[model samples]
Target: MEQAVCCYRHQDRETGVRCSRCERPICPECMVSASVGFQCPECVGQARPERQAQRPRTMTGGAVAANPRLITMILIGINVAVFLAVQAVGDSLVQDLILYGAWPPVDPTSGVAEGQWYRLLTATFLHQNVMHIGFNMLSLWWIGPGLEVALGRVRFLAVYLLSALGGSALSFLLANPNAGSLGASGAVFGLLGATFVLMRRLRYDSRPIVAIIVLNLFFTFAQTGTIDWRAHIGGLVTGAVVAFGMVHAPRERRALVQWGTCVAVAVVIVALVVVGTYRINH
Candidate 1:
């Protein structure tokens, strides 16, 4: 018996129903009902044959699905872990430790030796309050994955570290000489700025992103209470410059150029901080 049928996917024709897999119309006599729907005999055989022919693709997809990058997750975990550790150590200790984590340029006259140069980078991993770290880490979690996917692990790490260092350098130059600051907002702002540049370079729609960044900048200036506007500006500019370099550089030389430019910019920032500190001390 022959029955009128329509295409399963397109539903426009009354011709014999096409096979779910191969879309070949089959008369009732040739159609076979399967677990999902009716499949033509040719389709069933072809499905099996094609599966046998391309078995490797299935395996590769499975492998790709299983192996996600662990580095970003590990960094978030460490940040949270350190926050918890600071909490355990108590509040007064946290204040002192946080101050220690901040980068204060060496005073040339008093010869105030720099305690820890690593603080330029490490301070970015610390946050002033639970709410502060929570928000920053959340932003990192949301944006970090996409960036890591686009730029790969090494480049992503470079962008983050350079941005942090840039922020620290700015703070050391512009902040009150006796004051100390620590937070991940600088690095987070860097990621935000880099994202804008990346979207623009890719010719992706950027209206929403521009609005968000503008609002954040407005909020930074509006809010008082020890907010480090200088650090935010520094990190944002550094991230944008680095992202621009990456987008323009040749594919093979992009990573090298991006990293080199970031390092060079960081050196210039450090020099400026040193010069500023000498001027202040003298």
Candidate 2:
């Protein structure tokens, strides 16, 4: 490095500090603090250098986030917005969006059986009342952010949507063909399941999450006539499997196992939906 008389960015301002990345002379105003010494504004704004030793990662191989709660907040916002839409639009929106294996079972004119397969996932977002949305969103907030931080954004989102899909798939298979169900309970349970898996992975005390799960499962079964326990159970099992892969896969082949778990779960969801649809129609 050549000795310079003044800062690279400002010839008038002299400085002794050099950017750790680019090794350029920088003044106090232009220099940004870095893990090592200092970095110029441009270098600081760029993505972290590919050097493995300097790269920061979350426990399960996710890039550390500046705001871990961003995804959770977005999910909550979406749920609130959808709930408001349901309130304003009335029963028609509910009819169109609610998850059903088949509607008017004798006629079999609509539902997953009638090629409206999107209901499997969309129904998870449709909430009919304040209490329903309130509890589910609260559960999501409590469980989602930490998992998002640990698993990274894309992987965390995969767990959520897939869990929801798993729930819808099971409900479609097991619930009455004419019956309708909607809620984020499946995804919430999924997040809870994933959280428990991570706690076990880290060898932390697992009793708290276990207790929570047992309590929720009891609540689910207690209301079985009105509630679809299948969705909750499906999401729970799927999330646990996914999180196990996320936290336990060998570091050398981590990406393969993690994504393979997601793909495999997705295949199962698709299969369940197909079989359910076939049975409903026949």
Top-lDDT structure, candidate number: 2
Q: Give the per-residue lDDT digits (tens) of candidate 1, residues 1-282.
A: 976676444455555566677777766666788777779777777678876666432110111212345556866887888778777887654444442212344443222224345556666677768898898888888877766656656667677777777887777666655566677778778888888988887899989778877988898899745677877887888777776776566656755776678778878867856665555555
What TM-score does candidate 1 reach?
0.68
Tens digits of per-residue lDDT, candidate 2, 22-70, equal 9999999997888889899888767456464566887778887889998
lDDT of 1 at 256: 74
TM-score of each: 0.68, 0.83
Q: What is candidate 2's TM-score against the reference? A: 0.83
CA lDDT of every candidate:
0.67, 0.86
Among residues 3 or more apart in sequence or in different chains, the pairs in candidate 1 whose N, CA or C atoms overlap within 3 Å are: none
Model 1, position 63: C-alpha lDDT score: 15
